[model samples]
Target: MKIVADLRDRFGVEPILRVLGVAPSTFYDWLAREAEPGERELLDRGLLTEIVDVHDRSGATYGSPRVHATLRRRGIRVGRKRIERLMRAHGLQGAFLRRGWRGGSTKQNPKATPAPDLVDRDFTAPGPNRLWVADATRIVCGDGVLWMAAVRDVFSNRIVGWKTSDRCNTDLVLGAW
Candidate 1:
């Protein structure tokens, strides 16, 4: 239909419509249709603008579920599927945080001697402060990456000390102790 309309002046509407397998009367009816936007389409345009605004304000980290929730909070009544369709239509996407491998290798080092196991898989201790377990992890935050060290008393199964820093080093472990 669109091709026939665009090429009507150049090659004539009859030939174009015949080539495109569209009848002349059908094309004429479509061309003579109302030019005004439908009510539902107008409402969708407004809703999409609001959705884009919310998505932008969230740093593009909000998916349809979150976007729908935000819209509901603002007193906008809409379904999750509708929001998803609008987002997909406009090529709007959300940022996803992925968890990568951060554990030690399974294979042991040939040159390094293995340290003696103090706990020997025994996590319980007689009392607090008797046996403490420590570990460190890296957290990705909005500002930057942060290093965290935590010390837990095995007996109480509670964290006794903790420390955080921008850099992961021996001092972080020492501070947690």
Candidate 2:
């Protein structure tokens, strides 16, 4: 629309519209919208103000879900998805609170000492055998779960060795090495 408005004076409206493949009615509608925003846009602006207010009232902790609930309780007819879109567009976010906490399956024992980061965040090695990283993970099969361990050479960026077992233990990792 801005392009058409700018070039219409030089090329004429119909020619510009023809080249741009925009219908005359569509161009006029865009002009009307620029003069006065559509109803939905006005509603969105008003709703954004209310959303900001609600977020402030909650110490900026109320996300779209909570804001939508509050607005509904106060007799406002609004959709949760619409509230979500507005909140997201305005960069409003809520603090993440996990509903349930379950420990990971591969958690290291507290008594065990963690392996030193020998690579120091650098994976590049001068030679193939100089740096070999190893990792192990559990995989589920048709019958049951299996543990897989792998050793990769940093220089070659290839798997040097790998092994799979029904049980995850030191033997499985050592077998890969």
Candidate 3:
């Protein structure tokens, strides 16, 4: 339809309509119709305003499901699918909160005695196996969370050893070495 309108002045309506596979009478009838919002369109506009208001009031944390529930609580009956559709159409989205490490200390262990800085932060080693750095990280897998520990040689910057286990403990790091 937009193609027909844009090319109508250039190529004239008949040729454009024929090429677009649209009848000329149908196009003319559509063009002559009143340019007013239909009942459903007006309702959607009003609903969109309400949806935006609800989304803002919730600090943009409420998705379509929660928004639908909130509307229902306020005596505005609407489907969850409709709310989802409207939110998507208007480019509205909910906040996504990521889960981070929560339980143990992520820093150096305070209970254990601190080791002396022998290298003084200089990672360069005289030869292979002379200076090795060890670290562990948690990986999320399909079964569950798995802990991985790796030992890297500073001379070659290569991983000399690695171990994966279900538990993150001294044993895991020792096994890596």
Q: Give me candidate 1's TM-score against the actual structure.
A: 0.55
Give a tens-digit lDDT track for model 2, residues 49-97: 9889898888787888999999988888899999999999989988675
lDDT of 3: 0.87
Ranking by TM-score: 1, 3, 2
Model 3 — which ten-residue stretch has the worst lDDT?
A: 97-106
Over 1-177, each residue of candidate 1 has an lDDT whose tens digit, in order, gives 787778889999998877878789998877765355678878899999999999999888899999999999999999999999999999998877568754642456899988789889888888778999999998878777899999999888999999999988899999998
Residue-level lDDT for 46 in candidate 3: 90
Q: lDDT by residue for model 3 over 45-130, one digit each (tens)?
A: 89999999999998788999889998998889888898899999989989775687555535777799988988899989999989
Which ranking of candidates, highest lDDT first? 2, 1, 3
The ten-residue window of minimal lDDT in model 1 covers: 97-106
* TM-score for each candidate, following the candidate numbering: 0.55, 0.41, 0.42
lDDT of each: 0.88, 0.89, 0.87
Instruction: Name the runs in model 3 displaced over 4 angstroms.
Output: 1-113
